[model samples]
Target: MKIAFPATGTDLSCLLDGRFGRAPRFLVVDSETNSYQTIENDGNADASQGAGIQSAQAVIAAGATAVVSVHFGPKAFQVFEKAGIKTLQADIAPISDLMDKFRQGVLPRMQGPDKAGHAG
Candidate 1:
């Protein structure tokens, strides 16, 4: 399974980004192989409108089956739900610890967006 995470940097040692839509990048981890890919979110983050939707689409296009973030905007959460991508929420923490929480089932599955949509 490829799980996506809004991240501060390109690797597991980095912290998870708190703002999902404006995250610098997304770390897509392959649970099976323990390998990961970094998907740049700079372009989406720069969008004055629809940053959440744009980021969601990028994650979907990257083939992410799940998303782990501190919070999600309504539009982005809707897109993920519609696409069957599961979402889990965690407090700001190291990317490695977040993934560990996910694997341990300690992270709560998000039933809806935690934050209101941004100016988009």
Candidate 2:
């Protein structure tokens, strides 16, 4: 399974970015191999509108099966749900620790967006 984490840097040691859509980048990790690729989110990072939708589309295109982030807007949550991608809530932590929590099923799965639309 490929799990995506919103990150402030490219490596596993990077801090998890709190803003889902506006994250600087996304670290997509291969669970089996422990390898990862960083997808730049600069486009959405500065977007004044539709950042959530755009970011969600990017994640889908990157083939993420699940996402671990601090929050998701309503629109992004809907997009992920429709795409059959799981969304999990995670507090700010290292990418490695977040992945461990996800692997252990300790992270909470988000049923819906915790915040309103267009929240940066």
State the displacement of the C-alpha of residue 18, model 2, in Å, after optimal TM-score superposition: 0.4
TM-score of each: 0.95, 0.96
Clashing pairs in 1: none
lDDT of 2 by residue, 1-120 (tens): 899998998899999999988898899999999999889999998998889899999988998999998999999999999999999998999999988888899999898899788643
lDDT score for candidate 1 against the true structure:
0.90
**Runs with alpha carbons beyond 4 Å of true place in candidate 1:** none
Please, what are the lDDT tens digits per residue for candidate 1 over residues 21-71? 899899999887878999999898899988999999999999899999989
**Clashing residue pairs for model 2:** none
